[model samples]
Target: MTTPTRRAAQAGSGALLHSLFRTKPVDRIVAEGGQGEGGELKRSMSLLQLTLFSVGATLGTGIFVVLGEAVPRAGPAVVLAFVLAAVTALFSALSYAELAGTIPVSGSSYSYAYATLGELVAWVCGWCLLLEYAVSVSAVAVGWGSYLNEFFDKAFHFTMPAAISDSPGENGGIVNLPAVVVVMIAMVLLLRGTSESAIANTIMVFLKIGVLLFFCAVAFTAFKAGDVTPFAPMGWAGISAAGSKVFFSYIGFDAASTAGEEAKNPRRDLPLAIVLSLAIVTAVYVLVGLAAVGAMHWRRFALSGSEASLARVLDESTGRSWPSMILSLGAVVAIASVVLTVMYGQTRILFAMSRDGLVPPVFQKVSPRRSVPVANTMIVAAFISVLAAMIPLGRLVDATSIGTLFAFALVSVGVMVLRRTRPELPRGFRTPFYPITPLLGVGFCVYLMVGLGGVTWLVFLLWALAGLAAYFLYGRRHSRLAAAPEGGGPPDSGKGAPAAGEGEP
Candidate 1:
């Protein structure tokens, strides 16, 4: 016979285990659109606007600057590296498309995880996003500052003092004043509202595509077959190493899906924008890599100091001053847009987490007039500003890549879990081939993660540990779900609207 005390003990253990893995109700998240506490963000963004958001975020700072560093690591085989990174990106991207189309929520992978995997996993995913968005923006800002300094020296014959232009801990400088300046500028624009940010992103997307196309046209004119003859000189090890670093270039497309609430047609447009933007950016990255190496041998390419390598490649290829000058100028504009879009993503993820009472209520406070999370944006900006001023770009890029790969892998797994747990859930987009697609997504993400090197793994472990500590200290006890009535906890995305593919009328 079971004793009463033993029964109670077993019940207590079960409750503890349940609470540890408590899942947020998807219907509740979907219901918030029609009757949430704070006023909702405007749904003024069209499919085209959302697509531009994806491209604008992914195309800048990366293709413009990464080649100088990646080329030397992989020799001319960095082209294959870009292709490998693209395959990894494509798989995770498919998983993202399925979830974004299904949930149509602001939290991206974090929200997706909450609806399927449980709160603990959701918190971990959100924490990883903090690392991904913040570090990527800071790295882009540092790259922009270097390009800005170069533009000033060439166009104006003057450069900012190295003491302020370079990062504090590296390069013998006091602070990266220019990097901090760009972050502040983006902060101001976001506080204004989303509409202004969207418009700027659309314009910058066009400019970035046009400029990269221009570079390719000019570089091919100087293309020499001999330059690529010794391709893969460093072989597969080099290719894999550089692929890990270049993976950072593919991260920003998910930022488009983060705007699910403000999108005009979340179900139809979110997945399209995610896939389209990635395809566009991948094509551009490969062509530019081929053009650059064919014009200038990979062995001689180096990012020594702060020079903008693309602009240098253009100048050397064309043997003229104007082409390089144009490339540098375009790079400056392109990177600022990247900063704005990425910072917006960081804020929204915090806003979503805060709304669930995971972090703190302070992050949930939205501005009524602007329909934006003003306090959240400022908090993200302040922290990112400090990091940009202090850290080196190379280190920031590596850390960002590792964090993003982890979050992406989790999202891929979440897709498979949701399918098994809630097969009845309406999915606007289904990942083709089901389990295989998501499994490969997880596999590739893990492969690239290992390529990030041992140093990055140590830093990432420390970061993940801190997130777990914070969750237990505050998030667990105050979780909105546990506080709800006997059935479960609450808030949602589209007001209980049946998912587009979930047998909706």
Candidate 2:
């Protein structure tokens, strides 16, 4: 459908130039949904299952680990930061709902960009997504280590030593063994298959929610009006900065969109799951942030407050250890679930790319009995486990927010493009405020990216450069769209556009 261009015969500057601007026909992608020659994944997830997947992915480390770091930036006004970030997330969520409802395929934002934007931009989106999901998994895994250590100290009366628990250059440690172990555990579970993983995720979600509610009940008992005095002490600048940092918490909602092909009734359920998960997580973050701040003064919240900060707050407030001990268990469970969801997101994204011939076919190979991309999961798991075991948590999180923002911006743009290009296609969900919602989604995400600083920008540019090199060196010549015969596939598909995701915050 794309004029049947092949890199083998046109391996010249002409091919290179064509690679940059070459676009996939919307119709061809639409056909990929029904009776695709490329082999389809089984659709088994319902709306409830999809929602649990999203919530499980989103409600993990961010609220548990990020609050302590963010509160110091905005003081009591970190509550407002959560609110602002949720608003920012809603705009993108609406766009994702539109695209997911329209396409209902496995690529997420990468798929949407390919159908509406072009191949090169799609490659870049997928590349940025690699940073988002991989780093998120690593970062969350590291946080998991902290929580696991905390749980041992609280319930078992002992803790892992710094040498083996912390990452390189942190507290005199070289690598995080717990982090590596958690990541591998997730990999094993994933290898078992998607439905098995989904059920595990659902159980974890309920456990996490129950624990947060318990914490809230305990925290409000210590609430004092005096502590919240002088809210917004650092002013709007601080609130904005904190908002950018907390934005990571809202990224997991897109995980639902990544399961587009595997979701039963994807067109109807994907958008619902995306929106519902965002709403549920936003409420949880706001309530948790509010309760924690009310329980203790904001200045006490710092980087040292990481891992078991909420538990520490409860222990200090009630002069009891049992509350903190319980919270430690919750954090451990929550972080594990996040690792699982994030790793799942990365493998599925790679699987979609492989099926499109943008990457090696090994990633596209599905297990005969399990119906899962076992090889893809292993490759992603190995890379993330190394990153989790080696890198400091802070560094791992730096590129994730910026990468997610860039991907979200592109998806917002894609929504507008498709609205104009294929206006006749029925969308299951549409963004309210028309162009304004998407415009705000793009503008706000860019603003947050700017807030991340020059160092992050330089790192992202370097990463983007590496992705581009890989694309030109290998992916361009091997792309399925570039080699496929004309008049293949359907008009266009958007029921569940697999997406670019940063895992649970």
Candidate 3:
């Protein structure tokens, strides 16, 4: 693990300060556009929008789909796993908030890496983010399809064929049709532009939260405290395993940090978003987990996919089909929102990278009409839809955890590195415990990574190797920072040459 040199790390920091503080390409674009068009990019997001985005992203598939899997692993102690995962997420999120405030860019971890680590490492981090958000969204889409099938079966007495409901590995007939459909829908919404998606997400967020509240209300009626008597029947190992398994629920909290560029006041709102989102979501997760397990035995959970586990919990506790049907419908809506939000994050990161010349110019092309990256959104949707339709959600979820842990580890390390090297950088929020907090984040993330299967590690390794190869073969030669003339570009051509204007390719 070669860490970035202090000097190379400062390169991006300089760029950030210059881009944000001075009159540069970004300024030129804003000036060229009327006032409102440029203003939206920099205007601060409200506390409500920030909170909703975070909770909405974090609440999706993890609770609806992961609870069954985790319950089996940790027995009745799954609630503890939720608490521990929240702590780990809290540490990393604090670090993320600090960096987001300082860097204030759209690239999230990728931008931070570029500013501190250099071109090569930034490229790798961006690649890891691709695995984390894009693939995970698709995985969630597959889970959404399973729940949709169940919802339809109960509500309208209709069902998709098992083949269309499940992946090939799970004895399914064909493809995950609903998963594909949902991804396409999200794609269409994204292409329509950011405002439309935000409005849709806000509605989805309400629906998801309402359903969870309903489940909690109904579930408590069936709750029996005796079911949790042997809380740690599986012991510390089980608690750890469950925590690792369910950590994905907390993965999207960083979505708040990603919007630092667009934030009204990133330094103030970003930290609040990160902390508040985690606090709220963790409380909901713990309460829901406790209520469900308290209502029935943990042994009742069968680990097939999202639908099977949820169906089991519903029938065992309620002894009726209607509640399960409602839960299934909620899963469909929640997971679809999650996929949309997560995919949107992925595209924005790519947009930041392309704007910096880390990737191809095509990814940076914001539509003159809508201010959305039309080509980039379509390209990402097309790639992920195939995964959603064909790949098993279980495999994708496990892989996504690995990618997320890797990025968290990097951020933790970056926090320590930046503090020592550039103490002068203005951080709106500082991580609580300094070396201890970041180190804890790293240790916890690594422990979770170990709990994942060997196959996940192997796949992650392959992906990283492929990313490194691509960076050297393509990105390094064409990077904007590399092409720019020290002071910031208004340079020459498209490929390997500097960019001149705001929207020019």
By TM-score, who's the top model here?
Answer: 1
Off by over 4 Å in 1: 1-9, 33-37, 169-172, 230-238, 302-307, 391-397, 490-495, 498-505
On the 0 to 100 scale, the lDDT of residue 322 in model 1 is 82
The 10-residue segment with the lowest total lDDT in model 2: 496-505
Best by lDDT: 2
Kindly indicate the candidate among 2 and 3 with the higher TM-score: 2
Cα lDDT of model 1 by residue, 1-505, tens digit: 5799899999999988788787877787765431123655667778788888888888887787689889998988999999988988999999999888877878788898888888888998899889878888888888888888877877887888889999876667899999989999998988888988898888887887888889999999999999998889989999988897688778787888788777777877888889998998999999999999999888768743224677777878878878877788788888998999989888878878877889888777777888888888899999999988987767646766778788899889989888887677677788999899999999988887776678788888988999999999999877888788742653433246643222221
1-505: candidate 2 lDDT, tens digit per residue: 4444555546676656665656676545544542222345567777898998999989987788788789989999999999988998999999999998877777788888887887888898999898889988888888888888878987889989999999999999988999999999999998887888998889999999999999999999999887788999999999988998788878889999888878877777888999999999989998998999899988888844665678778987899998988888898899899899888888777777877778898887877667788778899999998898887768546766788889899999999998898887667788899999999999988888887777788879988999999998988879887776531233345343332221111
For model 3 the local lDDT of residue 257 reads 64
Q: Of models 1 and 2, which has the larger TM-score? A: 1
The per-prediction CA RMSD against the true structure, in angstroms, equals 3.0, 5.3, 7.5
Candidate 3 regions with alpha-carbon error over 4 angstroms? 1-44, 162-172, 302-306, 391-397, 486-505
- lDDT for position 191 in model 1: 87
